[model samples]
Target: AIDTVKSSAATWTEPAQSTTAAATASVDAAASSATDFMENANAAETAAASEAEASALSIGDYITAGKTRSQIQGYGGYTDIGGTILTIESITDQTITFSIVQYSDSGYAADTVSAKQITAQWVKNTAAFEFCDDTLDGKGYGTLSYENGTIHIETRSNTNHPTKLVLNEDLVGT
Candidate 1:
């Protein structure tokens, strides 16, 4: 019994492994992956920006401004957006050239800015193309939706008139 209980208690030292290098490597890899994630996100942002094309205002279509005031007056108040309707003279993949026609100036100093081209960018949404106001200098004037060869204009107005204008048919209904 004495021998079984040995004079000196059996001492055991647990084996251990150094994890410093492994841990450091794992942290470094994670940091690298984070950088890659940021780069990918930036690339996706760029792609989305470049994805905008022109809208569906054909040459000769008429577009009556929702309300000719602030934004519709053109950059630097140079254009009064004169009178009532705008006659689209030409349309490209990125711009709409139009001329104000039909009536006299409403209030602002009369200025019939002819051949005025405005940025008309849009992104395809399934079967419709929605107006891309990303170039509005952080201001959203309204929304334009084009589908089935017709233009649907809706101002983000919370008062008076809402959800207005339909190009082809149902012009009176909207």
Candidate 2:
């Protein structure tokens, strides 16, 4: 009886250790998966923040704002430099009916978007909303300025494809 008991004890201890190790491994894997999911969720939201901005803005209120380099994945990033908001007429889902304000540079009262130098609206597009142009990621859309909360997009490259608008960062949906 003693011999049988000793043998059983040794065998049981090995399986118990194995079981514990397996459980530990499973728990670790689950934790890793959960962490990955949370990271991906946050990344997805940041990437799609621009879309959310487009849907929730008023005319005159800037759809695009701030200075950030345009990524080259889409159409072809607009070589933005940076500018201030001037005036805005409208920024609807179908049309960004801006009230085109005059972006001041030195003594230039003339309007039209500057080259990729006037940094504004890092993410603006027409394909998702207008169904016309791709991303229009060519040159600087223009220099935008602000006048009493109204916005203006002044650039020489205003084409038929209505530029899609991106909302300011503070307004992105959480």
Question: What are the per-residue Cα lDDT tens digits for candidate 1 across 1-174?
Answer: 776455333321111123666778889999999999999999988877565323333555444434443324343454454333444555556544443322324433343322233335545521122222222212123444455444444323223322221122111111
For candidate 2, write residues 1-174 as lDDT tens digits.
999999999999999999999999999999999999999999999878866655544444233344322211112334443333323344444444433222322222232232221212323432111121133433224443333333333343335544433222221111
**What is the Cα-based lDDT of residue 148 in candidate 2?**
31
Give Cα-based local distance difference scores for all models.
0.40, 0.40
Off by over 4 Å in 2: 3-7, 34-38, 51-86, 94-97, 101-174
Which residue ranges in model 1 land beyond 4 Å of their true spot?
Answer: 1-18, 53-95, 98-174
* Poorest 10 consecutive residues by lDDT, candidate 1: 165-174
The lDDT of model 2 is 0.40
